[model samples]
Target: MRLWHQDLLTFLPRAQILGQHRECCALRGLGWGKKHSTIDYVFTYSVKRLVDYHQLVLREMENRGYKPDQQWYCPEYRGKNTVPWTCTLRDELDDIPDGHIYPEHDDAYREECLANLRKKGIELFP
Candidate 1:
């Protein structure tokens, strides 16, 4: 699965935004460290980067009046069917990392995401 560029989070359609939230949850949980070509770049950095990126998706969802479970704030809160939370505890991040959350989320990646959306008949203008 792919994370639509963060810049597009605000403009993503409802389905996409929700899908992104699920994607983030998967990445944080069962999908962590799994090699998938579309999102391999995400594994290069700390899991904190994914958490930081997820905050954007959560914010946009909240802005649209959707209330996602706050439990997601924990870096290890995997959704359904997994070990008990206490066994997988991870230190909560105190602050977002400095600079771009993912250095790979550059202008080129933004345009690439936009182009992918266009292919899906979802046109978004920057």
Candidate 2:
């Protein structure tokens, strides 16, 4: 539902990139709204949603008159680091004890991400 700008230098250096959707994150409602949004999307939705959210964000930017680089990334906005669901105190209350861990514990985070992508019928790569 929100748009985001990417750091073009990190991914691409030629075009402006904006995103229609970004990661689902928890909202603390602090002065940093961008950081809040980034955290909210990651927790609100699955990892795929979070990843695709980044894409949605770009789409939004384009819709708003922002052109993207060949890789479809923005040059003005940067995604700041934030806490993730797995890393939060809530921990893994739904999955196996070990699975509750982040991508490292049992690869659950990554597994769930892939599963979600498949469930969404999304082809991540060209």
Candidate 3:
């Protein structure tokens, strides 16, 4: 997972890692000790398209049959699930820094993220 993260950073240096979660799972049908926890990351770049990117990802996760944690999202945003997932940074800062929005990509970057997930063999279900 670390290697994958590093490679992704190398490829998308301007990407901002919004959040990540780590959980342990068995590997090769072995017991818990056989492998370490895996880290799943959430990233976004352009502030202009940040909400768009979030919507796209949530849609893909649903299409792929992956369950998203309800706690991390807002219940009443621009029409329920239409807004970006609740980002703590937004509350903390009046405006997102210019650096975070730079080196951003459009819809193409979304495809790349999905491809990376496929390569990692992440089903989230099944």
Work out the TM-score per prediction: 0.84, 0.25, 0.26
State the lDDT of candidate 2 residue by residue for 2-89, as single tens digits: 2222222123211223212222222211122444432343354333333333555456556666664433232212334433233332
Q: 1-126 in candidate 1: lDDT tens per residue?
A: 899888789999999999999999888888888999999998887777787889889999999999999888665666776542453335554343345678777889999999999998998774
Candidate 3: stretches off by over 4 Å: 1-48, 75-103, 106-126
Best by TM-score: 1
Q: Where is model 2 poorest over a 10-residue stretch in terms of lDDT?
A: 22-31
Listing every candidate in turn, what is its Cα RMSD in Å to the true structure after a full C-alpha superposition?
A: 2.9, 12.8, 13.0
How far off is residue 59 in model 1, in Å?
Answer: 0.8
Q: Is candidate 1 or candidate 3 better by lDDT?
A: 1
Go through the candidates in order and give the clash count of each. Answer: 0, 24, 0
Look at candidate 1 and tell me the lDDT of residue 70.
86
In terms of lDDT, the best-performing candidate is 1
List candidate 1 stretches off by more than 4 Å. Answer: 83-98
Ten residues in sequence with the least summed lDDT for candidate 3 = 20-29
